[model samples]
Target: MNAEIIGIGSELLLGQIVNTDAQFISEQLSTLGIDVFWHTVVGDNRKRIMEALRLAADRSDIIITTGGLGPTMDDLSKETMAEFLGMELEIHEPSLNRIQSYFTTMGREMTDNNKKQALFPKEAIVLKNDNGTAPGAIIEKNDRIHIILPGPPSELQPMFVNEVKPYLAGKTVDEIYSRVLRIFGVGESSVEAKIKDLLQKQSNPTIAPLAGAGEVKMRITAKAASRQEAEKMIVPVQKDIESRLGNAVYGYDDDPMEMIVIKSLREKEMYLALAESCTGGHVTDLITNIPGASDVLLESCVTYSNEAKVKRLGVSEDTLKKYGAVSSQTAYEMAEGIRKISGADIGAAITGIAGPGGATRQKPVGLIYLSLSSYGGTETKELHLSGNRLRIKEAAALHLLNWLRLSLE
Candidate 1:
């Protein structure tokens, strides 16, 4: 079924609050073979809401709304939608009782305006809200379906998943499934050029490309009468694409590069330590972002200054004086020293002259050295990354983990 998600709040339009509810609903609806063609955000204005309802009803089979179910004067979603649909608003007795009992159990006096939460369209099915006071609704009018959910993500997501999804399941005629394969080493254009032939002739499963940072994501979606058929249709296509790309595909879905490194480290029972100069502990931040990483991460030292490098990570004074702190020898020494001091299986260091500040004719800005040291060998790689300091730092950090993931594997 074709669908549209409407977020009802002025805060969304002002950028004061994000309408994450629409994104969450769209993803859930897509899994049920529902195509979400539009996402509309409207303020708490009766005229605008009526216009949105008219537009959604004309094009979409299902119209889902989130927000403006609170007990306040600005909450006008129910009143406006009732008038637009030409449906009378009636008190849903069960929803009223749920709201009333909640206030009584909390030992708070219930105001008359709070009863507004129980108001629903006549003959509408009430969807129970276990986490909040607002009771959601699902009204089926002829060929169209209208759903109203709470605005809070905690309340809205679970209510939709548990109560509303089952109600829509019986009416669905097909099921759609999608998987995203994330690849590194290849640009988005290059990846698309390699698979343009298959993408052009696509019918059952649609292929789309999205680029971010240093990775490209290829989303493959298939629709069918049954879940098994939908998955079966995409499997061959996924395998064929993987065979063409080989080892460049780093992850699937939403996996991060640090998670890949942590997985390999824990599997091999190896410990890692890092010394940061240019990246300013960003590499450590990425590694520690994963849960249960304390088991493998030994220590991380941020030696931003020459004195800090010499004092903390034991960079030799002569090396600092001769080749400078951003040189390959200093990076090699930093990595080796950290690994030796922390007694870790591996040590990595990032040191560079990140733009706009320190630049010379000999060693210009954006020149970075990434070094890795282990019991077997020690190696350093140089990169000249462009952009501002923060950008160069983030790129260097990600590049460090990606290299480690590939090398350790």
Candidate 2:
């Protein structure tokens, strides 16, 4: 079924609040094989809201609305919905008692205006609000379904999960499922070029590629009667994409580079150490963010200067003088030094010039050098990145983690 989301709020238009409800609802609806066609954002004005509702009813089979459900004078969702659908607003006695009891337990006065929250369209299904005072409603009228939810995400998310999901599940036959494949080291254009054929001839399972900071995400969505069947349909397509992309595909859904590195280390019973320069403690911070990292992360040293590199990671002054700090030789020395000092199974180092300031005639900005030292051998890579200081640092950290993940695999 096709759906449309109408957000009723002035705060959203003014940029005072973000409408995360539409995104959440769209994702949830897609899983039930429902397609979200349009997202409409209207102010608290009644005329615009009514217009949006009328347009949505004509085009969409289902209309979901958020916001404007409260005790305040600005709240107008229920009144508009009841008028448009030609339903009488009746007091839901159970919801009224719940609101009254809530005020009684809190030792607060229950004003007459608070009773407004308990009113719903006659014959409409009441959606209980466990988290707040405003309850939601679901009304099916004249071949269209209208669901009204509160603005607060805390209330809307739970009410949808507990009440709306099951109601919608009964109305649909097929289910939609999606898997995300995370890639690094390759630009978005390159990855898209490799999968252009899949995108052109797509039907059942669709491929969508999104690019972000130093990484790309490929979302593979399929529809079937069951989750297992949907996933089975996605298997061959995913395999073909992976085969074309090769090692550039680092991780999967919700698995960033750091998590992949930590999982590999823990699974292989290995320990790792870090020596960072231009990235400061960013690499170390990313690694330690994952749980159970302490067992595998032995030590992390930030050797910013020549003295610190010599004192902490044992980089010789001669190498720094000959090839400078951001060099392959220095990177290799730093990696080997950290591994020897911490006695870890693996040692990774990142030394770069990520900046708007630090640049000589030979070494320009965004020149990065990364190295990894393990039992097998030591490998080094150089990167000439572009962007602000923070972006360059983020890229360097991602590169270091990707290298570690590739080596472990």
Q: Using TM-score as the measure, which candidate wins?
A: 1
lDDT of 1: 0.90
- Local error of candidate 2 at 100, Å? 5.9
lDDT string for model 1 (1-409, tens) is 8998989999899999989999899888888888899999999888898899999998999998899999998998888877877899889989999998898888998899999999998768889888879998888886899999989999999999998888888889899899899888788999998898889999889988889876789999999998889999999999989988877787888788888889999999999999999999999998898998898999999999999999988899999999999899999999998999999999999999887889898888789999999999889999888888888888889878877888788
lDDT of 1 at 136: 89
Each model's RMSD to truth, in Å?
2.3, 2.7
Top candidate when judged by lDDT against the true structure: 2
Q: On residues 47-72, what C-alpha lDDT tens digit does candidate 2 reach at each position?
A: 88899999999999999999999998
Show where candidate 2 strays beyond 4 Å. Answer: 88-115, 303-311, 317-322
